[model samples]
Target: MEQLTFSSAQEILGFLDSALGRDLLLVPVWMRNLAYRLACLQEPDNTALLRRAASDLQFVGPDWNDTAHQLLRSAEALEAARRDGGLGH
Candidate 1:
């Protein structure tokens, strides 16, 4: 598999949108989860993307429980940051 690189949320969302438009099952679950994870990292304050990433990771199976938990934790931190006015947007 090629290394996935995403610099911005728009780029990540565009890639995800395109992948979702096609037969997503054709893509491996790991790849899909990785894309979502990267997107979440790019926009950590985006609760929707973070939750989506966590959900996708959970779907990858029991082996990913730790990672999924971490994503959820990150989402919680992001929420706290938002409430604290630490995030600009």
Candidate 2:
């Protein structure tokens, strides 16, 4: 497994998007896990996590920026997992 270095929700989302492009079903499980992890790391409604996630993406590979945008498109899907009492929250 590749080691992930996400410090915010955006980075997680970006990572998720990249994973999804490879294989939707397979990436969701891990992406959701990372999302939950990122959410947990957040300061409870504070946008610091989002900001951090954005910053983290900059530290990643160039493709991560595009990945982040793709993930942004699937916010509802990600949130749905959280609403269903998934891992991130």
Candidate 3:
């Protein structure tokens, strides 16, 4: 399968919204992760986006266990940092 690439968050969001609208549960896990990764690249310090991406991956089930775990860890670390005042508000 050809990999899907996104130049911006709007493109990813549009794809995801369309998928959700069509009830397309068959959207590949890698594609979902790619969207999340691209969004992260655009806004690396957005903890809320990280958490939402992790939750979104979890919602897709366990096909990509390592990627899901990594996202969860990243979100947790960012949340912890924010709580500890490691990240400036």
Candidate 4:
């Protein structure tokens, strides 16, 4: 595979908007550090994406995955409540 590089936050942000960006959090330390730096910029849109990435930090085991799903649901429920909208959590 060809090496992927980002010389600026814009490049990284663009990548994050792509399909491959779904694996952003699973990347190596250097890439995670880059994401952290990007998140620190406090852009609302990117912040939400960062939050979604954080939510994906869960165990792969079935039992653990269930708990993780519930945890993510709780967060979503809270956000929906804040917005006065929920599919019924």
User: Best candidate per TM-score, number?
Assistant: 1
lDDT of each: 0.76, 0.52, 0.73, 0.47
Ten consecutive residues with minimal summed lDDT in candidate 2? Answer: 43-52
Q: Model 3, range 14-81, lDDT digits (tens) per residue?
A: 77778867875757766777787887888777767777787787787786566667867877887789
Per-residue lDDT of model 4, residues 1-89, tens digit only: 01234345555555555624576445554454455345434443333544554444442234445544554565565667767853342
TM-score of each: 0.71, 0.33, 0.66, 0.32
The list of candidate 3 runs beyond 4 A from truth reads 1-6
By summed lDDT, which 10 consecutive residues of candidate 4 come out lowest? 1-10
Which of the two candidates, 3 or 4, achieves a greater lDDT against the reference? 3
Q: What is the lDDT of residue 48 in candidate 4?
A: 53
Q: By summed lDDT, which 10 consecutive residues of candidate 1 come out lowest?
A: 1-10
Task: Judge candidate 3 against the unseen true structure and give its global Cα lDDT, from 0 to 1.
Answer: 0.73
Candidate ranking (lDDT, best to worst): 1, 3, 2, 4
Off by over 4 Å in 1: 1-7
Q: Clash number for model 3?
A: 0
Worst 10 residues of 3 by lDDT: 1-10
- Using TM-score as the yardstick, the better of models 3 and 4 is 3
Higher-scoring candidate on lDDT, 1 or 2: 1
